[model samples]
Target: MLKVDGLTKKFGELVAVNSLNFEVKEGQIYGIAGPNGAGKSTVYNLITGNYRYEGRIEFDGQDITGLPPYRIAKKGIARTFQVPEIFPSLNVQETIRVGSRFGARGGLDKKHSDEVLNFVGLEEERLQHAGLLNLLGKKKLMVGAALATKPKILMLDEPMAGSNAGEIADLMDLIKKINQQLGITVIIIEHFMKVLTELTETLLIIESGRMICCDRPEIVTSDPRVIESYLGDSYAEDK
Candidate 1:
């Protein structure tokens, strides 16, 4: 479980996150959504210790606010960036193995690396250079690498970005398996309302770095503030 309270982040003159608070229970798929520059990703940064911020972040009841990223990761938190980041020169298997070195509770293991490669459906491409993979393949590889860390919670940033409908569906299925079969708590930052509504148990909407509403995805999507801030009137009517 993860808990964030009074989280605030400032970059010189601009406030990126303002007193944000949310809780992600164990085994739940929590979601976050906001328009561009709404500080959705900034919250992840603050939680993962990318920057110093005002507030407390607790993972499984331990304070993790100011810890460095590696330490946080070692405490069972793993994350993927908005863009798929892969080692261009490393083979797919090697790329995943490198991530295997960062397991939250123990040192790397080859069997776990193999399991991650297969879990993400990249077994056949394990020998290929990472730079050669297509967009979807690269995304899967990135997720596989994150899985290699054996995290209890995986924070995904726009995992559906730049994907076609089919790709989005594929990612949705994969995410489900990760939560169900792998039993990992998930916190996803996404702009796609349909994905959030369909996949998340709880959704949090924010604007100007503050919460607009936090509730069940269905309720959050229907909230007037959420509709006004991100989902347009037409989209709201369809929902």
Candidate 2:
């Protein structure tokens, strides 16, 4: 489990993230959504210790406010960026191996690495250069690298970006498997309403860097404020 209270991040005169409070229960798929500049990614940066912030962040009951990014990753938290970051020269297998090597345990976990490769559907492409992958393949590789870290909680930022409908369906199934089959707690920050509603149990909506509402996906999506600020009138009728 993770808890955040009064989490605020300021850059110069701008407050990217306001006083925010939320919790992600163990073994649950959590969702975060808001329009651009709502500080959604800032929250992720704070959680991962990318920048110094005001307030408290607790993971599994310990205060992790100022820990470095590596320290946070060591504490069972791993995340993917909005854009897939891959080493151009490294092969797919080698890239994931690097992840396992830098993971909490700090070793080459061949079994888990192979499992991640297969889980991400890149088994056949394991020997291919990571830079050559298509968009979807690159995203899968990104997720695989995070999985190789053996994280208790996986935070995905815009995992559905730049995908077709079929690709979205494929990824939804993959995300479900990551939560259900792997039993890993998930915190996904996404723009796609359908992905958030269908994949997550608890949805937290934010606006102007603060919490707007946090509840079941259906309820949060149907809320009038969410419809007004983000979802629009059409989403309410879809319910």
Candidate 3:
């Protein structure tokens, strides 16, 4: 559904993302993993039009490399940040409505917004202020707002961060349902290997903005170079 070829981004002398190439199939959960400052988030920034990149990015067969961020969002791509972001003053329902209004080409749909709130398991909290919610609630709200945009592909950055085991399970189930039931393509950037193995079909590993490997989770995780460079010798032994 989305293809990136030779995508490179540099800030002065520092090459944040270098010649990164990958593809995300429709209705698939594609995972990206790398250590901190490995240009993982920078790739997303380049794809979403936050930076001027030296490469090609195509979605549904059209080039979107130099488009502005809002234009990219309008082109059926929506993303959630590593940190939960929402309007602190707005109620849950109102926050989602803002997304719907901005993202929907035809304007906001109140019924659809309400359904999105319920879909993210925030129905009862719809009228509550967004800042009053706990971490998990805020995260769910962030996902719900992104869903409200009606994106064909959803890119999530560290969606499981700061969650307990049960909350992680809940979010994982929700992500699976969003992919399997809703039929939206998913691109997730996460640190947890188990989560990637369980949820993603294709896993892309990168370091210093270069591809280490790209294959099925099982194959990529078992790769000797991948184990040595990213997963470490200890994780390799456990395998």
Candidate 4:
């Protein structure tokens, strides 16, 4: 479980994240959505100790605030960026091995790494150069590497971006497996309403660094303010 209370991040005169509060329960998929510049990613940065902020972040039970990123990662929190980051020269297996050896708690878990390779559906590409993978392949690799860290909670930022409908479905299935089969808690930040509604039990919508609503997906989607600020009239009419 993770708790973020009064999380605020300010850059010069601009406030990127303002008094954001949310809780992610263990073994559940939580969702976050907002328009551009809404400070969604900044919340993640604060939770992962990327920025000094005015707030308290507790993981499981201990206060993890102000811990460096590496310590936070070692304490069973892992994340993926909006863009897939991979080593161009490392082979797919080697890329995952890097995380296993460096980021994971026990360090260099070969059995777990092999399981992750299969879990992400990258068994055949094990020896292939990481840079040669296509978009979907690269995304899978990124997720696989993160999983290699043996995290209790996984945070994905815009995992659905740049994917076709079929690709999105594929990823949705993978995310489900990550949560259900792997038993890892998930916090996803995505623009795809369908993905959030179908996959997340609770959705938190924010704008301008403030929460508009946090509720069941169906409930949050129907909120008039959510429609006005982010979902828009088209989404309202479509429902």
RMSD of each: 0.9, 1.1, 0.9, 0.7
Off by over 4 Å in 2: 237-239
Candidate 3 worst ten-residue window by lDDT: 100-109
Clashing pairs in 3: none
What are the clashing pairs of model 4?
none
Each model's lDDT: 0.92, 0.92, 0.93, 0.94
Candidate 3 structure quality by residue, lDDT tens digits, 92-137: 9999999898787677989989999989999999899999999999
In model 2, state the lDDT of residue 178.
Answer: 95
lDDT of 1 by residue, 70-96 (tens): 999899898898999989999999999
Top candidate when judged by TM-score against the true structure:
4
Could you estimate the TM-score for every candidate?
Answer: 0.98, 0.97, 0.98, 0.99
For residue 201, what is the lDDT in candidate 1?
A: 97
Top-down lDDT ranking: 4, 3, 2, 1
lDDT value for model 4: 0.94
Return the top candidate by lDDT: 4
- lDDT per residue as tens, model 2, 104-151: 476789998999999999999999999999999999999999999999
